[model samples]
Target: MALQVQIGKTELKVNPIGLGTNAVGGHNLFPILDEQAGRQLVQTGLANGINFLDTAFIYGPKHSEEIIGEVVKENGNRSDVVIATKAAHKMVGNEIVMDNSPAFLKESADEALQRLQTDYIDLFYIHFPDKDTPKYEAVGALQRLKEEGKIRAIGVSNFSIEQLREANIDGYVDVIQGEYNLLNRDAEIELFPYVMEHQISFIPYFPLASGVLTGKYDKNTNLAEKRGKFFQKELFEKNLEKVERIRKIANEKDIDIAHVVLAWYLTRDAIDVVIPGAKRADQVLNNLKTLDVQLTVDEIQEIDQIF
Candidate 1:
């Protein structure tokens, strides 16, 4: 059965797995092996009943969003799927600076609309807050987008509790996106509590911890990348070691590691829509299949122990 979850005031039935387009043409950190493969991945995902797809404006230097727009346009009937994309981060000089100002948000929305070939997005997120931009500036910008009918809903990704509190002070934000996985639960401390009390959505990115909880990486293996190489260190190593215990529980339960971690998230009180990026068609299938796996309270507890 497909799982349907709500995001704030927006009511839409969605499969728990959202096809994330971070690597559509390629992210700034990762290079795309093939853009065609990325488009095919979206088609296959839609065919498999995935109605939610996440992408961003600055990916592939913005080539990825263009490709997504082309593919979704070619596929047609764009109404069948809910398109979720983010803004606020752009390349300025050699650094990736944040631009969450209302004016920038409006400009980015128009550009994203043209790229996605749609007038209104189902859910639009402010990619992340940066020291350069004020929270009210970002949140106020999103409020304007909502009023102008450019974006149907607004959310923020990668917010600390203090940051989230600042955004919600105006009650303009509809969702709060963060990196919450079996390993990372700091959001549970204050962020989740705020969301639960106010009825805001929690969209967890890196729900799989960059594939560490997927059981694909081990102590013997090392992660490297052009920009992703920055995450390699002792803390990451300890996190991977903790994943081994979750892997064992997944094995004993006869479920894939991704399923256990995803299903475990569903048991939480927060209204979550976890988007795990899949570079290939089969990975998309595997992630969507987690909808069928139900985690027991004990199983949820067992996995939570390591993180």
Candidate 2:
């Protein structure tokens, strides 16, 4: 049976395994994008029982949501799946700028609704915070949208602890999406505690640390130019060392290292779901395999020590 988890205080329940759809319609993000493969990816997830999907407007500037909308139509009703999307960036000529003003958020919500072909988004998030806008005021706009039946739940992504505290002052925020993984436990410092106290769900993006936790790369592996910070020699070497420890554990348990890493995340507090990106149907199936892997307290401790 698939594991069902609730999103914070919201009534929405979904399979713990969710798909991150950036690679699906994100033509600008990846090389040689395929429309058919992207549609098949979502179809495969729905066919296999994965109902939670995380996407953003900045992903291909608008393409991922479009593909998701098409897949939802072909699959069934809008309620059949939980759609989470973010909007905080707008293309200004050739530059993408972050805007968190009330007017822009409202406009973004309307655009997202039209693009997703849904009456109300399951969860709507502010993808990134702009310097000028007051965080709480931006969240207030989403709160109003929720009252007007435009969105079911509110989310804030890529926010600092201080920003999140301000945004959730009224406990209006339902979920938080952040960069977290075995390699990055910085959230444990303050963000995790606050979210847990307020009953907010923490949905981790880059849960695999840009595929490093999958144990596919070693010291000699040359990361692609697009890897950015992941391309740093010191960081890559450290990640390789940590992954080696995980690989040993996976070998001992007779499971894939990726499965062990993802399963271990469920053992932490306040993490309701994890959205690992998948460009192929087989990757979605492979991610779902995490459901079968189990980790003990000792193993969790060991994995933590490795990092």
Candidate 3:
């Protein structure tokens, strides 16, 4: 079994490598998806020692959480898994908007608990910041939920540094999830320092950069319309070059480049968990291989310089 690590100041402990379920049942996020494959992915992860499962309400507008709930219920191991889910999206007629009000967040939590078919959520994150709500106030709602035993931990995702500061003002925030990877180091500039000083765990999304950092693409590979601006010709070509350098290290170490990349993030400060999404059960198992990748200081630094 992979050793579990604490989620920020919370008692909830999870495998360092978690399964991101956006690709599992997120039909809206992805053009096409197999519901059976999504169920199998969650089942494979749980049976194979992966106890942390990350999902959000916006993913398929609720499908991901539903699928995860069904799997956990069927597996009969809800006690063994650490489930982290987020909410902020609310429907107003036909349009969706972000909401952080106490009532909305509390309602979202109750809805999530029902969808997850669990009595209590291990971790509940305010998925995104709304322009109208005070950041601290939004997190305060989660604090109240914690007090009520509805949730064990509070988290905020996609908040700016200032927003994070405001949200953590009461010291109720336990974790922060944001876009971070070797390719995108913006969080390292300020977010990393704050989280480390505050003893907050940082869960990095897109740890694989949508598969760009997996070392599967080359100059000849066509990714023009794939990842929008990130895959624009010039930058994509440049990133491919850096990935080749990572490939060299992976080859020398007899490991997959994706594993090397995931392992590298594990060594970073304030980064306690990496949720790499998988579309199939085999891919979920493959992500677990990252646990065995041990990189030396020299190798870590070399990869850092290459990025």
Q: Which ten residues in a row have the lowest lDDT in candidate 3?
A: 221-230
Better TM-score candidate (2, 3) = 3
| TM-score, cand. 1 | 0.90
TM values, all candidates: 0.90, 0.97, 0.98
**lDDT for each residue of candidate 3 in 175-216, tens digit (9 for 90 to 100):** 999999888999999999999999999999988887889987
Question: What alpha-carbon RMSD in Å does predicted model 1 have with respect to the real structure?
Answer: 2.5
What global local distance difference test value does model 1 have?
0.78
lDDT of 2 at 115: 92
* Runs in model 2 lying further than 4 Å from the true structure: 224-226
Residue 184, candidate 1: Cα error in Å is: 2.1
- Could you give candidate 1's per-residue lDDT for residues 246-275 as a string of tens digits? 777778768788788887887788856778
Worst 10 residues of 1 by lDDT: 222-231
**Which number leads on TM-score?**
3
lDDT of 2 by residue, 211-307 (tens): 8889888877866653666658888898888899898889988888999999999888899788888888999999998998878889999998888
**Model 2 per-residue lDDT at 89:** 93
Score each candidate by Cα lDDT: 0.78, 0.89, 0.92
